[model samples]
Target chain A: MNAALSWLESLLVLAGLLSPLMLPMLYFLLYRPKRRDGLASPIDSLDARAARPSFFQRWHCGLKVACLLATCFLFISPRGLAVCLADVAIALLATALSRPSWRRVLARLAAMSGFLTMLLLMLPFSGAVQAGEPTYSLAFLPDSLPLRLSGLGAATLIILKATAVALLMEPMLSTATLADTLHGFRQLGVPASLTQMLLLCHRYIFVFQHEAARMWRGMRLRGFVAGANAASLFAIGNFLGMLFVRSFERTQRVYEAMLCRGFTGEMPRAAAPPMTARDALKALFWLALAVSPLVTEMYFADFMRFLGE
Target chain B: MHISDGVLPISVSVAAYVAAGAGVAVSLRFLRPEDLPKIAVVTSAFFVASLISVPMGPTSVHLLLPGIVGILLGPAAFLSIAVGLILQCFLFQFGGITALGVNALMMGVPALVCAGLFRWLQNGDRRRAMCSGALVGGLGTALAACFLALFLATAGENFFAAAKLALVAHAPVVILEAVVTAAMTGFLFRVKPELLCLPPRSKWRGKGDCSL
Candidate 1:
């Protein structure tokens, strides 16, 4: 039993860490594609007594930040990249080849390849990327901290690292989260007021983004050039002010509209289904996978030693 | 630049996470649903803003805007900064997953201080407000270095020595942070003058000053 458990542990580690690329690829294919409509999604179903998609049905939030957090949990896990990628490629290829028609295979290939390319671009720009630098090591420490204060400090350190990772993962996940807000959270049984708020926010986000971009272009055209070296940042700041003003005014009308429709802090209902057992399992599985690194390094001597802590 | 797993002592890293978490929780207390989008915009702005880098010395360091966030969001500044910091860690590997908290506080607290100080600045001279943002931006970077130093010191006894060495390592970086922050402040003044405004004085008269 012990030997079998050990093998299972090894497999879990590999699944969690070694194959980062594999999971993302699978997720992209399976995600039922986002919002086939725009932010004001033309009032869903348009039938009396049918559920409407609360104001911002067609918009995406910044939930990518949340997905990235889950991704980091994978990065921390110990696994074999080559094996994972090869396995995933095989899965994709199998799916493609098994298709009854040539057109479907080509479409699949194009989609997969396009996705792979975006990840390739996103990585360099991702804040999570670490540059090569010398790291502090803890090899020469005594087995136990010297006293209670040492233990206190030990507790402090763990909190610090967790905060760092949480902070880093939050924004990235927020984007994916933004994208998946209504569908994902609705499944989670989030409050309607909260959902309505997020939907509204998501809908208007592009307005801010557009304002920011326009201000940026305007500033550049005016020679307020902060600098690619940094002279350009002034424009970015000034743009923020403009973005805020427009967003603020737009928000007032939205609030009034909601109030008129009996939106007493509670959002109108959408026909989102409840969470299923499959989603529960999927959530737990991913949670485990995300925290697998700490688990692996904590429990497995071999992996811990391999990581050279 | 945020250190990750295996980069720092486990004890120091964990402590940072806890403290930063507490700080974030405090911020959440005053949070309103409406603040989410503003926070998101600020979060995206901070994340994208760093992509524009400035060359200093042999290497380059991007802007750290915890101060600016603090100036804009006050104590709630932590949420905006945390979101941006988390995204950076995951996607770009700007910092380590393990070191997220310490980084946040190092940056977050300073921004908070700057936000408060910006308010106290001569009752809303736009230039003073920008200066406050500038100071917060630079101060946050400097404080982060100190927090990092303190974090290293607790890594073990040898880290005390390492902290000394690390202080020297951060000196030039601090100067650069100040320069960029100051430059950013000056730029913000010319481009976005509204962020420096203290929410129409009526905001402070309210019970809680929280945003998402």
Candidate 2:
């Protein structure tokens, strides 16, 4: 009976270690089936959602970007687990209040699973082993594979902080159109050339994505399969070459058209509306909320000490 | 392979942001106003190309294309990469908002280095240029992996293992990028040789191909 229990524990630990490697397979098997109908444009759906007015939508784009990004930085600050949890709770509340599509938020989190899983698998064993630092060893496993508790705690903190910032992204970006958000960056002193490039690049990504899908389908019809081989890589290379050729030709025509429509060296910028007192108040509220977790972690040592222990 | 938020210490993240900003400023110093739209359009194509996933055993890896972008765009590759990364962050959340600086530096620095290497080595004929492209493509991925490992190591002693793992994972990708970039270069040489000759920004008249 004792041996059986030890074997079970070893299997559990092994499973925990290997699960992350299985995630990509599972993700493809479950989620990829729904995406067969060509590439769906995320921008159209996001723009439609942004058309709806909400509390976050009312804030000036420049101020909104600054405040939310500040919150994200604060979320990642070193703190106890309780403070991390509070940061996550605040992020979730902000996300909910902003009224974004639940599906998109979940998708954002899913995109992060790969990197986080890597950290989860490697950090525990890789941490510097110190004297008296707690470690977990399993029966039927190599003695060298000691999972450090301190490393586990560090990983957990990273995971929580990463999740919080990722959740906050939907509320920060989806509340405004891409162009408007970029315009906000311009107002915040980002170079105009860079902002223009972002806007123009974004506008054309959908077009090129469609072009690429069509080319891919055509390649498939010609018996070109994408596999782990030189032949597949060669075919993909040809496909990309053709894509670049076509895009370069199209750019000349596009530029000519723009010139015909009175294109100057610079794109015209729309003047931003004056900020109001309510916008300031909302910004202050969010800023304070962002700061609360750090304050609690730093000042209320007695309250946070128990959670740390 | 992009770094996510909260993975790096705040100080490292801030320092990366500053370094990446300086890189962009240097790239932008040679910018031509009239070429803005062209660069933007090319950037879209680069973005789309990166979305393509090539199958590996059991799993797959997406193309980084830093070498190709560098070879094609020359001095503008850094700026183009920075823009592409920002779009990836907002649209797909591939890299975190705060970690954007780190991601850009990881990819963009290699692109610049590969571009310079290709320009120096490419000579003689189409076959030689293709060989140079293959060399630079593999080198670009290798360099990016090194940067990633170096950045992760900055977090603490605990992350040293993760850093090593990240480097090893890119080994296969380096080979894959090499083959694809070579094939693409060969195709371009056959189809439109003019694209291979990216003229210096000051000398480009923006109307016709440079002397080939």
Candidate 3:
């Protein structure tokens, strides 16, 4: 088989890499964040802020997700590609169902575009050469169409795989609040100590950002301007050190308060409700749907060959 | 350099995840229970640090400070990086969940190595500490860039250009982090010398609390 990608695949790779640039506009056009109240939303109030799912409901969705991700990892053929695309479509549907803020999707797409671009640029040009084959070099007139086409294929595969998986995360992550998700993970058997630590760390990122900003303002008021020099470097160093010292002191105080409240290494968590038969069935259904493509692809490979003939 | 999802083959991504998982497990094991809050604080600091970019020539690069994390947090640095990476994934989507393990490994392993090197070289000399601080900072970023390249190259021969470009792009960051880590460590050495010590460990560990 020629290792290079076809022009169609190359175009798909490029499109996948660059498509996210339009996501922000799409998001704004499709989902507006503002209400008549004029209050800016951190996340959508509809699905994200609504009633939390039961432990069973959450796990059901979790199982479906696990199956979806596994299928994505397993299958790499055209049928497998269709399955991933289907999964992405379902995930996007779920995100729309949740009425999540367009900002979140926009951010996810924006975040992914850089890595996608890098992959698109690199994967196509780095073709592996077989014995007696022409070396694939970057030139105005290329010698190896096979190499270029294969490269395009590799790039497309990467872009598609990444895009599918990333799109799946939109619903999983943005559909619920962080607290609920953490609780879901806790229910799923992640250590409470770690989850608590994650929550604490997450919460403080905002707090410390504010503190750091105030400190930066203080530095600027004192005529500090960061530059590529020793003085500025040292000043920034002192600023970070100061931030650390203050944070450490704050940690001490917080720890003491927690200790006073009988805090153990791990925070106490409520036990999750037991799963029901319906939950199992729901999970099973989604799992079936998720893996259906793989099952069909495997069983139908011979049939596909026969059809091609 | 966040690897992003779908770049590396499943085999490579899985391998990176396993390696990163091992690192995180070891980090968790060595982490003292009492220092959970402290780790959280440092993790937040590291998270915020990555957001603040400093101007370098015509372009600006964000602070990574993996060296600083390794130096201060010691064995716990890997866990710290993992935590920071998770938040970055969720909040900023800086890296995808699929690539989380690889990104963590790229940043965390270098942190572990550099932290160890920094400690060994400093050996309580002020001059050595300053030089070692700078060296580890640069070395950490360089090592991370190398790891990033390695991960990208895992896709096959087709990604060498991408790998090279990625590595070259980080050169300025390498220098920047080196200077920043050096200055930060020196400043911490002078004031609150205890903060420079490898964070307290849970296991039977060395008692060099004030080594720097």
Q: What is the DockQ of each candidate?
A: 0.15, 0.69, 0.48
lDDT of 2 by residue, B127-171 (tens): 787898899999999999999999999999999999999999999
Over 4 Å off, model 1: A1-210, A222-309, B5-15, B31-37, B55-60, B89-93, B96-99, B124-133, B156-212
Output the better candidate (1/2) by DockQ. 2
True contacts kept of each: 0.08, 0.79, 0.63
Docking class of 2: medium
Q: Which of candidates 2 and 3 is the stronger one according to lDDT?
A: 2
Error of 2 at A166 (Å): 0.8
The lDDT leader among the candidates is: 2
TM-score of 3: 0.82
True contacts kept of 1: 0.08
Candidate 3, B1-212: lDDT as tens digits: 68777777777777877888777767666667777788998899877767776767865668788888888877788888988998888666677777788899999999989878876775565566668888988999999999998988777788888899999999988888888888888777777667766334412135445321
Against the true structure, whose TM-score is highest? 2
Could you give candidate 3's per-residue lDDT for residues A203-293 as a string of tens digits?
A: 7887787788778877778887777777777777677778887887888898899899998887665554565687678667756765665
Could you arrange the candidates by TM-score from highest to lowest?
A: 2, 3, 1
Segments of candidate 2 deviating more than 4 angstroms:
A1-5, A10-33, A36-46, A303-309, B198-212
Q: Can you write out model 2's per-residue Cα lDDT over A161-185, one digit (the tens) per residue?
A: 9889988887788888767877778
C-alpha RMSD of candidate 1 = 13.6
User: DockQ: which candidate is best?
Assistant: 2
